[model samples]
Target: MNAIAFTDVSRSYGNVLAVDGLNLTVETGRTVALLGPNGAGKSTSINMLLGLIRPSGGRIELFGRPPEQAVARGEVGAMLQDGELIPELTVRELVDFVRGLYPEPLDLDAILQMADLTDLAGRRAGKLSGGQSQRVRFALAVAGAPRLLVLDEPTAAMDVESRQRFWAAMRDYAAGGRTVLFATHYLEEADENSDRVIVVARGRVVADGTAAQIKAKAGGHAVRFTLDGQSAAGLDALPGVSAVEVTGGTATLRTADPDATVAALYRGTSLEIRDLRLAGADLEDAFLALTREP
Candidate 1:
């Protein structure tokens, strides 16, 4: 069974639509990324999945049941952007507090270790730094041994070393046939960690595919050249060049065919090429191109 599914889901706040026509399917044992800029409804979608908000239209299913039902079964875990952690509670105390809510919970030590909070177990939540607070939230999320982990900017805390450790823990969790839905502003994290990538813009899904497939959807490769003292002509005007940007005698061409673009760039100009190289397309490129302001 799919871990979670949303069919044409939409959420509105009065006259404002936060999420619109969102359709998603996430399977067990895989990590799915929900990526978008601010006001893209990434948080709203996650809130709906967590049973914290209601969709205004369409349907949502979690583990063959509604979100609320799945949540009631205590199989869902969440670490939201804003949490209400008790100030006086230490990491150990907070873990114990969340653990008590579940009938069967994972070991406290294991959770703390996985979240790199073992050393901070005695530190109070209010005293912990931003990164440290995030780790404590992660510890609580995993305390119940959830079958579905929903983390929003889960690794916004933690140094590089701790982030990798946390990622390994997530990989192990998914390998055990659990599901994870991750939302973050960190593009590199989504590109590196997810099995599938979902891009949301204006509260709608504009792209959904693997890392390579999504890049391919944007277009083929391009050729970029830096000119010395003349304007770049013919290259930007090529038939296959989809988009072009020129500044300070430097031009970047987004082309549908790389070879054609390269051949055309040097066909008519002796612009004193300082550097000429093929730019490989990737998620960041696609995102910037697709979401360009009209």
Candidate 2:
């Protein structure tokens, strides 16, 4: 069964369309990364999927049921960007409280261990640091042993170590054949952690595939070499070159057809091409190319 489905989904606020005719699906047990620029409707899409707000148009389903019904049954777990914990409650208290709401909650001790809250289990929510608070939120989200987990910017306040631990925990949870869908600005995280990535722009999907496939889709390859006291002019005019950059004595040309670009470079440029290299585009390069406004 599919974990999520969105068909012709859209959301608008007054004159602005936050999500426009979005169509997507995720099968059971797959980890998907949802990526977009600011105001690209990632949060709006998540809100509607969680039933926090109604979609302005179209249909959505969660595990073959309506989102509200699935949520009511404790089948969906979410850690959003802005949810706040009860200030008066200790970490343990809060986690336990949320666990009691689910039909088959994970063991309290297990939840603490997974979220790495064992040491701070008794700390009051108000006394915790920003990163600590984020961990607490993760604990709450997983307390129910939910089948589908949704996280938005889950590691925003976390340090490097905390982020690593968080992804480990997430991977452990996902290893249980559960589905995970996360939205994060950390493109590296999406590249390293997810099975698939979906990039949105102007409130609609612009790219969807594995990281390698997406990178290939966005000007697939790069040709680089050292320029020995030679002009960098006319590099952009080369066949299949989308962009050209020169830093120090090195020139890098991004191209959809590296073969053509390299042939033209050898035939056209009088510059000495030293230490030449050809490689696939990285995720960051692909992201900038795809999201850059025309």
Candidate 3:
């Protein structure tokens, strides 16, 4: 069965639509990234899946059951972006408290170790640093031994080292055939960690694919060089070239076939081409290209 499913799902607040006819399905054991700029409905989609809010239209299911039922059965776990831990409890106590609510919780010691909270287990929840607090929340998310994990901006508070350790722990947890869905603004994190990426824009899905495939949708390599006395108008007509921009002595070309564009440049242009460079499009490029207003 699919881990999560949304059929024509939508949510609106007053006159503004937060999510619009979102149709998506997540298979078991896949690490999927939901990516979009701010106010793009990613949080709304996640909230609906978590049962925090009801969809205004269509339906949603988790593990072939209603979201609330799946969550009540301890099959779904989530780490949201907000919420403060109880000030009176230590890290260990907080995790223990949450674990007790589940029917089958993971071993307390194992969860602490996995989340790198072993050192801070005794620290009061209120006294811990932002990064440490985030790790403790991660421990709670997995404490129930949930089959599906959802994280929203899971690494927003972490430093570089903490982010590394967090992803490492997540990798280990996901290795056990558990599905993971995370919403993140960090393009590099999505590119490096997720098996599939879903890009949302203006309350709609604009692109969905693997990292390489998404990048390909933005076109191919970008060729930039200093070419004095060259007109960008002619270069824009070159085979495989999609767009061309010229600024003084420099020119940038977006192309589908970099090799062909380069060959054409060498053969068709008499202007001096110095400091030439070719670079493949990355996730940021794809996002910008796909999300641009039509």
Number of the top TM-score candidate: 2
The regions of model 2 sitting more than 4 angstroms off are: 220-241, 255-288, 292-294
**C-alpha lDDT of residue 130 in model 3:** 93
What TM-score against the true fold does each predicted structure earn? 0.80, 0.85, 0.85
lDDT of candidate 1 over 73-148, digit per residue (tens): 8889999988868998888998988987887788888888888888899998889888788878888888898899
Residue 280 C-alpha lDDT in model 1: 63
Q: Which of the numbered candidates is closest to the native, going by highest lDDT?
A: 2
TM-score of 3: 0.85
Pairs clashing within candidate 1: none
Between prediction 1 and prediction 2, the one with superior lDDT is 2
Q: At residue 20, what lDDT does model 1 achieve? A: 89
Error of 1 at 173 (Å): 2.4
Clashes of 3: 0
Candidate rank order under lDDT: 2, 3, 1
